[model samples]
Target: MTEQGDTHVKRKMPKGVRKGGTRFPRQTLGDSLAWAKKLVAKTHLGPQPEGVVLSGVVGNSNSVGRVRLSTLKQFGLMEGDSKGYIASDLAKRIEAAPTEERSALYRAAVLAPPVFKALFDTFHGDEVTHAKLKQRAAELKVHPEETGKCADVYVTSMVTAGLATLDGDKIAHLSAIDMGTPPPSPLITEQGDTDEPKVADDDGEGPEDETQPEAPNPKRAIFNVNVTLDSSLDTEKLERQLRLLKKFGAI
Candidate 1:
C-alpha cells in the first residue's frame, strides 16, 4: 500500500522536481535562464520579495520554487536571496541579445558557478562521465553523497546550454571556450595593431551569419582539413586566415 501511494505521489509533481537534491540548481542552466527572463519581465527588472520572485519564476512559492530561485542564483542569472531577488546584468543582456548572440551568452551563464566553471575548464573538449564528475567533486571537496547529483546537474546543464553535444546515449563533445571565452576576444596582430576577423565556430558560421552547411557532423571526428594560403605574403586576409586556423588548433 505504501509503495502504491509513493508512486501516486511522484506523479503529482513536475518532472525533475523533488524535495531533496544537491546544493546546486536542480533545473538546467537553460531552463533557469528562461525562467529568470520571465521573472525579470514580471518584476520589471527590479528587486522583489522571495515569494514574488518565486511565484513569477516558478509559478508557485513552494519548496520547488525555492529550488528554482536558487538555481537562478547559482547560474548567476538572478541576484539577491530568499529575502529579495533580482536578475543579474548578464541575464538582462541575454534577455536582449538576438538568437545567435544568445548562444555565447548562454555559455557564459553556464560557466558562472565556480564548480561548473572549474569542471568545464578541466574537462571540456573531452568525454564527460558521471564518475569523472564524482571524482572531480572529491578533488573539489564536495560532499561524497552529493557527487552523484552534482554529475547529473552538470551533464544536463551543459547539454541544455549547448556547451556539450551528444551522440546517442553519450555526450560526444564538451565545447571549448578560452579561459573566459565568448564575446570574441580582441584579434590582435603580432605587431601593435588589431584586426577583428569573422570567426567561425564548430558549425562554420561566422559574424556574417552565413547559411549553415547541410548536416554538418557535430562529432569531433579525427579528420584532416586542407588549407591553401596564397604565396603572396601581402594578402590582407592572410593574417586573419592564419589566426583563425590557430584558433581551431589546426596550426
Candidate 2:
C-alpha cells in the first residue's frame, strides 16, 4: 500500500503518447470557429476530399494541418474521417448566425469538448490560475510539456464562449455559465399554480426551499472535515465534489 499523498501509479507512463493527459484543442474555440467559417464558405458545407479540405483550411494535410482538423473535431465544429470532411450542423448554425447572436452557439461548442466541460466544472467557483490548469491537465495524463499550451487554449476558448472572464494569471471568473439550457420555469406558474397539493399548510413551502436548500436536512447525520493537500492535489475539484455530494443529499 502507498503512504498518504503518494501519487505513484502502478504502471509506467504509456508509450506513444500523442499529447497531454487530458485531451485539449490545438487552437482556441474562437480560432476553430473562424476557420470553420472560412472552410465552409469555400466548400459550402459539402463533403470534400482530403486534399480539398486541407487546402480549404490549412492548405496541407501535414502536422499543423492535421492538428487544426483535430482541434475542430474536438470542438464539435467539423466532422470527417480519412475519406472526407465537412462542417457539422452546429458549425453551420454558427456560420449562419449573426456575430452578436452567436454567444450561445459558442457556449455550446465550448462544452462540446469533454476536457473543456470537465475543466469548467472543476474550477467554476474557484479562482483559476494558469499553473492550476496546467497541473490539472498533466494529472489527466497529458504530456508534461503540452500542458502549458493546453492551458492557454482552454482559457482562450472559455473566454470566447462566455463561460469565463480572464484577467492576467487569473484565468476565469465564471461570469456566465450557460450549460445550453434555459432557466427552469418557476415551479409555481406565473399565476402561482402548482401541480402537487401541499403536504402541509406550513412553510417548507418557505423561501428556504424555494430554489435549493442551502443547509443539510436535520434528519441527516453530519460530520466536519479538515484536509491538508499538497501542490499535487487539484484543490479546486474539492469544492466541485462537495457540491455534488450536497446536491445529491449524500452529506
Candidate 3:
C-alpha cells in the first residue's frame, strides 16, 4: 500500500470514544500509538534535501528556514556534514508485524520511549511561531486547539514509539538511516587523461600537442542592433515598436 494509505489506515481509531474526549485516555493513547507504528513502517531514512521533508510536513519556506537550524541542534539527529535522522529502528519493527497487530505494537513502542515527549514539545512550541499553522488548522476544518492537541499527541506518540524523530523541526526523522556524500565524478579522471595527449612534431622527434589553450579575453563584448523603418510605416506598428524599444532602453 502507499505511504499515505498506510497513514490513513493507521490513523483510524476504534469507535469507543467521542471524537475529542480526554476521558478516553486508553483509547487516545492506543490510537496515537497505533498510528505511530504505521508511520514508522512506511517511512524510510536517507539523505533527503531539507526542503523535501520539511515541505511534506510544514508549509511555507519562511517557517522552515526559521526552525531548521535550531531543531537540528536540539534533536542531535545530524552532525556536521552528515545529515542524520532518516527513521528509527522501532518503526521498521512495527512495520514488519502483521496488520492486525500493528496498532498494539505502535501503542507499546510509544509508551516505551521517554524522549518522544521532549521531541514533541520542542516541535509543538516551534510550530506555533508560524502563522501558517493557524491557517492550516482552519483549512483542515477543525478548531485550532483541537488540531494543535492532535498534532502534539500524534508527534509525541510517533517519537516515543520510534516511528519518528525531530531531526529538524520541519522534518521528522524516520527509517533510522544516515546519508553519505555523493561519489566523485568519473569525468574528472577522463578529463585529466585527455589533458596530456601527445602530438607528433614536424620533425617526428618531439611532442607538440601538450600545450594548453590560451587564456580568454577578459574584455566584455559590445553589440548593437539597428532597425530601419519607412517614414510611412503604420502608426500602430510604429507605436508598438517604439514601446518595445523604450522598454529595452534602445529608443
Candidate 4:
C-alpha cells in the first residue's frame, strides 16, 4: 500500500485595503498610457518623440510629469536615453496586438522590472497581504511610509498590466502573465531491449576517479534575540512574530 502526504502552506495576510482613493505617484499604467497617447495625438505625431520634447510639453508646473514618464519607461512600452523617449518596438507590437494578445503583453510589461518580478516569483503560489509586502520592503531597509506607497504602486502597475489581481488587501498572481516559458509536455516513451556498446580496450580500468574537492568550513557565530508577546498569542500573531524572527535571520 502507498500513502500520499499532503502539504500545507502558510499564507500571510497583507494589511490595508487598496482603494481608488489612495494616492500614488502614478495612478495606474493604463492611465499613464492614456496620457501618453493623448499627448501624441494632440501633437499630430506619427510616433513618440524624445523625452526632452515631451518634458517641454508637460511644462514647468507639472512636477508629477517626470514620475509618470518614468513609470511609462519602466513598463518597457517606452524607452529613453540621452536622445529622449520614443516608442519601443515591443511597445508598438503590444499596441498592434489583437485584443486577445493584449493581456499577455501587459503581463510581459509587469515582469520586465526586477523588483516586481521578484515579488511575483517569491509569492507565486502563496497568498500574501499588502502589509507583508510592505514589511518585506522594510526588511530591505526601505522607509516604512514609502513601503506602503511603493506597495500600492506595484499593485496598481501589475493589475493594470493584467499580470495580477488585487482584492481588498490581498494580492494574487494571475496565470495570465506570459513569462515566455512554455509548459512541459507529459509523454512517456517505452524502451525495449537494446544491444550494449562494446567497451574500448583499457589497461584494467576499474572506474573513473570521480572525486570532488571538499568545501572549506567557516567559523559559526550565534547571537541571542529577545522579544515579548502576549501570553495567549493567536496563530496570526505568532506567525507574524516568527516571520519577524526570520527576517532578522534568527530562525
Candidate 5:
C-alpha cells in the first residue's frame, strides 16, 4: 500500500536485497555484438581460459568487467555458470546476423532477462509511464530505492526495443498495431483450358456442335486470427502490434 507517483503500488516493498540493476544500457546490444565478434576471433586462436577472456577483452575484474558480463548474460549473448563464460546461441547468431536483423536480435536478448521479461509482459497491451512502472516495481515489492532504477532500466530497454517512446514525463508504449503483421496474401490459381462435353439437342442422341467450358475456381487464403481488444490499445498501438507480428512472421 504505497504510491510512487500517479500509480499506486498495492504491495509492500521488499527489503535487504541488492544486485542486478538494469539489464542493458542503451547501447548494450551494439556492445554485445562487438564483444561477441571479438570473442569469436579469439576462439580461433585457441580455447582460452574464462579469466583471460574477460580480463583481456574487457577491463579489470571489477565493476566494469562485472557490468559487461552481466549485460551480456541478460541478452543471452553469453552463457556460463560456475564454470565460466562462453558464447551463447544468440551471441553466435548475432555475429552472423545481418544488419537489419540485428535490432530484432538485440531486442530478443534484452527481453531474455527476468527483470525485463516481467516488465514487458506486465505492460503488454497497457499504456504505462515511467512513474507508473516505478510504482509497479514497488507493487512487485522491489526495494524502495531500487524502484526508480528499475523503472529507468525498463524505460531504456523498452525504448531500445522500439516498444516504447518518450512523451513528456511519460513513456508511452508503442501502439502494437503499427508494428503488427500485414494480412496474408490471398492464394491465386491460374486457370487452364479444359475440354467440355456437349449435349444433343434431340433426346441425348449425339454431342452438340458447340461446347462451353466451365469456369475455374480459385482458392482464397483465409486468415484465422482472434484479436482481443484492449481499452489501453488505440488504433496506433493496434497497428504497431500487427506490424510486429508481421515482422516476426507470426501472421
Candidate 6:
C-alpha cells in the first residue's frame, strides 16, 4: 500500500507550464458548422453560392471578407465546387432561425444606456452628430473609436431587423415619425377702415367760424439837401473829388 501511494504522488509542474494551465481549444468543424447553419437561417439566403450571397448580406465586407468566406468553408455547411463555394443541402434543414436572443455582450454593444443616449442624441439626419458622440465618449472615458463601433453594430442589427436602413456609407436612415396632415390656412386679424382728417380739423379750427382782419399800407419818405463851398475851390479838382466820391458811394 505504501509503495503504491508513493508511485501515485504527483510532481509540481514547471512555472511556465503551470502558468499556461489547460487552455480551451478552438471550436471544431462541427461547432463551426452549427454556427454557419445559424447564420444562413438568420439571413435567409437560399441555395446560392456562399461568396455571392455573403457579399450582399454583410456590410463593410472589406474588413471581414476573408474571415467570413474561410469560416463558412471550414465548416461542412458549404462546399467549394468548380463554380464557387455553394451552401450545402444542410442549409435547407434549418427552419427560419429564431431571432437571436440578446446576450449581455450584444446588449452592451447595442442597447446599453450610453449607446441608446448616443444614438438618440447623435441621430440628427442620415449622418451622426459626431461632435455630440465625441463629447459623450470623452466624458465616459470610453474610446471614441469603440463608441463609433458600438453605434455601427447597433445600426447594422437594426437594419437587418428592418427597423432602419443604410442610405450610404456611414449614413443610416431611420423610420420616419408618423405625423397627421397639416391644417389648411393660418389665422389672421382683419384690418379696420381708415379716414383722412380735413385741413380745418387738423388745425383745430371750425369751418363755419370766421373773423375779419384789416391790411395796412405805409407811406414812403423823400429828403432834399443844399451844400455851400468856398469860392477858392478848384473846379476840376472838385469835379474829380465828386466823381471819386460817387464811385466810392460817399456822394
Best by lDDT: 2
Query: Per-residue CA lDDT of candidate 3, range 126-244, in tens?
Result: 43322333344434444444555445545555555445554444435342222122322233334465755444346534435657565456795545768777779899989988899
lDDT of 5 by residue, 204-230 (tens): 334345565543445744456665657
In candidate 3, stretches whose alpha carbon ends up further than 4 angstroms from where it belongs are 1-45, 57-82, 112-251
Candidate 1 local lDDT, residue 204: 51
Instruction: Name the better of 2 and 5 by TM-score.
Output: 2
Report the C-alpha displacement of residue 87, candidate 2, in angstroms: 0.6
Tens digit of per-residue lDDT, candidate 6, span 65-175: 444444445323455542445555443343233445322222222222343434533452445444444455545555533455434444554444333456545445342
Backbone clashes in model 2: 5
What residue pairs are clashing in model 4? Answer: 14-129, 14-130, 15-131, 51-84, 51-85
State which candidate, 3 or 5, has the greater TM-score: 5
Q: What are the lDDT scores of the predictions, listed in order? A: 0.72, 0.75, 0.42, 0.60, 0.64, 0.42
Over 1-251, each residue of candidate 1 has an lDDT whose tens digit, in order, gives 46654664433656445434335556788688779778768767468888877666778676777777778888888888777787788888989889878877887888787877777767776776667778886677666766777767788888877777655445544545443444323565546454644444575544454575555567865567798989877777889889999988788
- What is candidate 4's lDDT per residue for 129-149, written digit by digit as tens? 999877765665555556787
* Between candidates 1 and 6, the TM-score winner: 1
Candidate 2 per-residue C-alpha lDDT over 200-227 given as tens digits, one digit per residue, 9 for 90 to 100: 4555455445677576798978777554
Residue 82 lDDT in candidate 5 = 26
Weakest ten-residue segment in model 1 by summed lDDT: 177-186
Give residue 210's lDDT in candidate 5 (0 to 100): 57
The parts of candidate 5 lying over 4 Å away from their true place are: 1-34, 44-48, 175-251
In model 3, pairs of residues that clash are 86-174, 87-174, 87-175, 87-176, 88-176, 109-161, 110-161
Poorly placed runs, candidate 1 (over 4 Å):
1-23, 175-251
Better of 1 and 4 by TM-score: 1
| Shift in Å, residue 102, candidate 6 | 14
How far off is residue 36 in model 3, in Å? 7.1
| Best first by TM-score, ranked | 2, 1, 5, 4, 3, 6
- What overall lDDT, based on C-alpha atoms, would model 6 receive against the true structure? 0.42
Once model 4 is optimally superposed onto the true structure by TM-score, how far is the C-alpha of residue 248 displaced, in angstroms?
67
